[model samples]
Target: MPRKGIALVISAPSGAGKTTLVQRLLREFPQFGYSISCTTRQPRQGEVDGKDYVFLSREEFEQRRAQGYFAEWAEVHGNLYGTPLAPVKDSLQRGQDVLFDIDVQGAAQLKLSLAEAVFIFILPPSMTELERRLRSRALDDEATIERRMANARQEMLESRWYDALVINDDLDTAYDALRSVFVAASLAPFRSPDLPEALLDS
Candidate 1:
């Protein structure tokens, strides 16, 4: 039998840079599929449908949710976002690992379903650095930045629950560390069903 694919579930606080890491991973390893999500928000500039997200109307999103189309769904800031079941299921069935840049809650639910998944958590170098990154974005108000920093503190506490953790102090160093994780996990001893037989033969 072929070696089964692994699920790479990565979660991070808002300013931890997991999203950037995941994007780089996909670009470097074209064989891996990045899980494209469905969202009820309008697409941003230069974002493509089905690639960036499966943009949906509120009614369509809710209708599909009712029809059991999504593997996971969550509402954020009054917008609904979800991961559709088909792409992920198809990728795994074809022995291709799927990478996800989801939040702590989504990662938890995914683990319950994809028990064999390798869960990873990304952390900022420090709370000070996290606040700095958040503020640097200039996208949120001061109150919002403070709220995110507070949430990051709580989310950082959950890092211990993951199988692997990487601190993004420097992008180059962090990417190297993240790449090593995927490479190691893919070839882990437990992944091969023929390990015992091969060992006996050797």
Candidate 2:
């Protein structure tokens, strides 16, 4: 029996190491497919157009958004971001898991839209450590970093409703925890709709 694919949504505040954990998971589990999101923000250095994100002009983004092109979309840090709906549905129907690395806002939207998705939240060791990590990146100015810190507090507050939480205090430990969540979600009976019948037939 072919099992239905799972939608695994991993969300975290900026500098929480969610991106690194997601990358490691994808590398370890090559079968998992990544959902490249569309964004209205300018690409960061070394970020590719389609590979990293479907970078779009604000006008184009609004047009497609109005057409109901996104499964989930949110404004974060003053930028609009969205995940396409079609590819995700196609992959799930084909029994190929899709991984979404989005923020808490996007995750909440996805949950309302796709109730069965497995939602996981990543946390930094502490707010202090989180700020340290963000500053180390040197990507944002003081004001921007301050704004992200404020957002992080709200995100963490919202994270209480997530199905699982992995504290990214240690890289390897966090990866193991995140990987375990995926492994467990894969075994959920709901994802294998034919399991009971197949077992009885066997």
Give the Cα lDDT of each candidate: 0.85, 0.90
Model 1 per-residue lDDT tens digits across residues 109-174: 787667778888899999988888888889899999988888888888877889988999989999
Residue-level lDDT tens digits of model 2 in 78-155? 898899988888888889998888788788888887787889999999999999999999999999999999999999
Per-candidate TM equals 0.79, 0.82
Candidate 1 runs further than 4 Å off = 40-69, 194-202
Please state every model's RMSD to the true fold in angstroms. Answer: 3.2, 3.1
Model 2 regions lying over 4 Å from their true place: 36-64, 75-80
Task: Output the lDDT of residue 77, model 1.
Answer: 91
Clashes of 2: 0
Error of 2 at 25 (Å): 0.6
Q: Report the error of model 2 at residue 186, Å.
A: 0.7
